[model samples]
Target chain A: MSKQAPVIAIDAMGGDHGPEVTVPAALDCLRQYPQLQLILVGQDAVLRESLAAHGRSDHPRLRIHHASEVVAMDDLPSRALRNKRDSSMRVALNLVRDGEADACVSAGNTGALMATARFVLKTIPGIDRPAIIVTLPAANGCTHILDMGANVDCSAEHLYQFAVMGYELVRAVENVDSPRVGLLNIGEEEIKGNEQVKQAARLLSSSYLNFIGYVEGDDIFTGQVDIVVTDGFVGNVALKTIEGLARLLGQALREGFQKNLYARLVGLMALPVLRGFKQRFDPRRYNGATLLGLQGIVIKSHGNADRAAFANAIRMALLEIDKAVPERIGERVATIFANGAGIHEDAPHTTRMNRA
Target chain B: MSKQAPVIAIDAMGGDHGPEVTVPAALDCLRQYPQLQLILVGQDAVLRESLAAHGRSDHPRLRIHHASEVVAMDDLPSRALRNKRDSSMRVALNLVRDGEADACVSAGNTGALMATARFVLKTIPGIDRPAIIVTLPAANGCTHILDMGANVDCSAEHLYQFAVMGYELVRAVENVDSPRVGLLNIGEEEIKGNEQVKQAARLLSSSYLNFIGYVEGDDIFTGQVDIVVTDGFVGNVALKTIEGLARLLGQALREGFQKNLYARLVGLMALPVLRGFKQRFDPRRYNGATLLGLQGIVIKSHGNADRAAFANAIRMALLEIDKAVPERIGERVATIFANGAGIHEDAPHTTRMNRA
Candidate 1:
């Protein structure tokens, strides 16, 4: 909307579809915003071909950063970092580090992207392990959940850090001033889950976060809490389960509409409203995946993301830029650690106290 | 359809709704299967009231097993078992132990149910810890995922037991011979998850199970594997997440159909087909929760399950009784530990080797 728009560096060689989807998406973002500055990072020849094919070569603010290689989806994080020095993902991360762009966006290998961001930009001050934040489309707006697959085995300290970081994210994007944070567990009672969740609940409660009591799986979409935090393993499963079920239900709706001529007519008439309702759950509008705890902002788009999804990722990056979330999160975690709140405690110890 | 149906003991004083839903559901089950015998276990006065009001007191096969106490949903597992001696859940478990019923069904407190079953019936011959098996509605049919909140912290041996037990379940119910089993993880690669998942993967590969390597959360509903094994902490979250998403999608669909007159007409015409499709995804039709690795079959229905859901749970109990899943699973686990297959190697040592 403004002339001084933010610039986002995109890894054109990353993701399942790569430049095929990324180039068109970048063009769409530019078309919509009119002022968006995009620095496309990828191989020179391929980038040129894709840009020309989209009739986007003559765009004023569009530029290309020539990087020669790519990190494959299956490439191990550590090995890829050591081996692929000039990869597009790495170069895009460098742009953010060097202050050439406000943020970096990629739909590439999630592990590789997270590793590269941490390796290059490093963790922000007081943030221990960076997390992946997923914004789920809920009946009452989108619910932001964190640590979706970044760190698998987390300490109580790590989870505390994730909650602090996630709280800031929900406030920043959803604009909820006092975001209610819930620890994901098997039951609503504090004592009803494994040691880790109980410990995390204790840490969250003791911190400055507006911590609600333990929340079960069903609570995630109930809008009972604004932010839900967990270890990546549980969070990842929750995210995937939601996606799979949404797809399943959508298919069922289609079949239902196709059953009879009356249904077909009804389906045609209801198409606009159904589309509107579905747009709320489209996932494209909510596809931006944030790598929390990083020194800078990094957003990972879905691998099969289309133009609309990628644009949304750009919009998310802009929101983060506006909120200064990473810095605020860093300050909060530092304050907690400085106070020496609930550290040097075992999982069971925390669990017992929290359950009490 | 048969002349002489199997007998199932019901814990009427269980679940959030208790006799309010359970008694009516039992009556419905008897109606659906005229030959089925019901052994209702609860306080005599309340059961009599519900039965009389429902006009089902005249049936000759309807029997009552009086139980004075009930298991509160939030009671600690250990405390509840030691203190609530005559609880309905405990009495129900005793029926299975006393051989008075072929199988028992409860919608009681899960922890208490698990603790009582373990205490009374004991673990299957060679199993370390009994798992909780719940079927997930998948694209092809359904996949039985084990340890869906029974055993929180699992060992390599525990997962090995779950796989064997889960294999027997799918083979008996789904009729899939040599069912494919997958260890739930963050990625599909052999080395893509946390320490526990990796160790379980290694042991599963060496065992007699049809180990199909690692599976991510998304793959759970694709019907790519017949069984998915994970620790209870993760499995619980996965199951609840799926449940939440299913309910959320259903709500969204209903809301979408009610937007206007056109949409309402579409909804009207699509009702039959939508209902049919929903029947496929309904948790009620698949409402049986098996307490795996037990000496006898004990199924836990949903706490708020209505007549239809409760009937499905009873139906599942009958099928398991006929298949003799308990006896088969016990034999499989016994063979693994008897041969000293993965147990002799030591789990920690395997974990260290795999990590290195």
Candidate 2:
């Protein structure tokens, strides 16, 4: 597609599966995107063993960038930041910051990744913090929900900024010019929810967004809106609830089939149909969590993601690189602040909330 | 079974389906529990006409108590408590206050039920606010979660009370002698949640209750704990999120089966097995939302419940009555407070929260 390929630097030793998953996933991604290159950032000896085990060697399009240290999954973000300066996760992010790679993908600890990325690449101007944006499978299409445990305590204006950033994400990735953005709350009525969310709703209503007012928890999967915004605490709980319920439902379905002879036969007979149904709700197809409001592209894959899911994460970075989503977001933020969206950088008072 | 049956008053004209759904559901409950008596409360003519239409009329076991007005689903809680003196919802609660009924079950607006019940039946001596408790379907059994929207804002001590009440609920209804009580938070760690939750955890760990530290949102339906305690804001959104996801999954499955001729055949072949799966997850089986902390029993059914679901709500009321759950909860509260568990009644500063 191009004479020079776009490069993605991957934290090869970051996830639970580590190189066993990332090596093959990266190889598969390289195969899919002919005009793409990869830099596997990890311990040199370990990466070489993984590559040899997969019966592959470094090529013109693939290379290994050695980082001696590994960031443990439970390592505190501050520890990773201060001590593990040369860790794989940080090195990959640095590649992006230095323009050596178009984007960076990591399956490392989410908290640490957010902290390291924000520290290395810095946040976009006019943005206070970076947020984790996840794509969930809804009825009509994928629905994006943000602030998924990135900032546990968010101000009203912070939530308003999330709405704007979310709006830009959907428009860029999903080709949705008029993405319906809704603030997640306890009820659809404007009068519901706590004070922060209520104020956020007011700010969104006045912005140049296709703001759909307040939506309830059920709206997350109803495909009623393209993007949903909430504070880190509630958003994180809601997401984990969905994950836990999905696993339970799958287990229950299997248990139901084991109850009787007829049930077992039906399970066998409808295996094809059930497979289709399962794939429709497959969580792996949507594996990447983009760190929005960052100056450079960074994606976080689930820790237990397999080869296919990890590859999906790489593809996600490629899409962002192809479209330059971060630049567009920065432009949108500048416009929003310029138009008196809020005096976020220096104003101590709650000006937008007060105006609302 | 005793010759003198436990009487349950039903708001005959409540819920979205009204008497059309309620009359049949009451009859079903009567058939199931021979020792149960029901008082259908509504406008005399509407009750009588609906009862006759369903081939049911006044009987020795079934009777009518006329309430001239109905509480509209969207009626403000304050308005319902102040103006709607003759509402069916209020009349039903009055029966419990007057000891004319063992319990009352209504499918009316939740806010109205909580407000009216608090005004008429009053809260138990130690509880400042009554909470709405709902039984959610879990992997092992029904898991109870509370403050399911009745109290929009709650402090740490209020959460402690929720734990005690939840503990007694499991002991009474499910026969779990030492019910495992857990506070719901974003993480299972003691330091995972906001200030209110962390303080609640401290209070609960020090209390006499068999508290099991903190639980995440997924624990609600994992059957890992008997009861999950959270503030109304998080609890309500989590419960409704589960509801929405359940409905979406069901719709997606049906849509999957309707895709092609081969899928259609599989649907037929697996009809019985799929039917079992559907029943195992039947939302109607988990319809009751009891208003915990009240002096009398008040259960809130989903406003759109059908005959089977509404009947399930009636059975829930009967079970609470059979176990004398309110009486047991009151004893537990007295036991908890008697042991010098901070003077929450009046502390001048942050009274409800300062107890911890």
TM-score of chain A of each: 0.90, 0.93
Candidate whose DockQ is highest: 2
What proportion of the real contacts between chains A and B does each prediction keep? Answer: 0.60, 0.62
Winner by lDDT = 2
Q: What is the lDDT of residue B301 in candidate 2?
A: 95
Worst 10 residues of 1 chain A by lDDT: A346-355
CA shift at B40, candidate 2, in angstroms? 0.7
Looking at model 2, the pairs that clash are none
Considering the two chains of model 1, state its CAPRI-style docking category. acceptable
| lDDT (10s digit) by residue, model 2, range B103-179 | 89999988888878887776666666778788877887878888888766688989988887878877888987788
CA-lDDT, candidates in order: 0.80, 0.83
Give each prediction's DockQ, rounded to 2 decimals.
Answer: 0.44, 0.53
Residue-level lDDT tens digits of model 2 in A1-356: 22346789999999998999999999998888888999999999999999998888776789999999999988888889899999999999888877788789999988889889988877776777788899998887879999888887788899988888888888988887899999988752323788888888888899899999888889988889889998888888888889889888899889877888988887887788788878878888999999998878899999999999999999999898777778788788887787655434532221111111
Tell me how many clashing residue pairs each candidate has: 0, 0
Tens digits of per-residue lDDT, candidate 1, B1-356, equal: 21236778899998888888888888888877767888899999999989999987667878888999988888888877899889888887788777777678998888888888888777766677878889878876787888888877888778877888899888888777789999888862423787777888898899788999988787787878889999888888888878777777778888878877877877776677677887888888888899987777899898878878988888898888778788777567657678764332212111111121
RMSD (Cα, Å) for all candidates, in order, is 7.4, 5.4
- Candidate 1, chain A: TM-score against the reference: 0.90
The list of candidate 1 runs beyond 4 A from truth reads A1-5, A188-191, A259-263, A338-356, B1-5, B188-191, B339-356
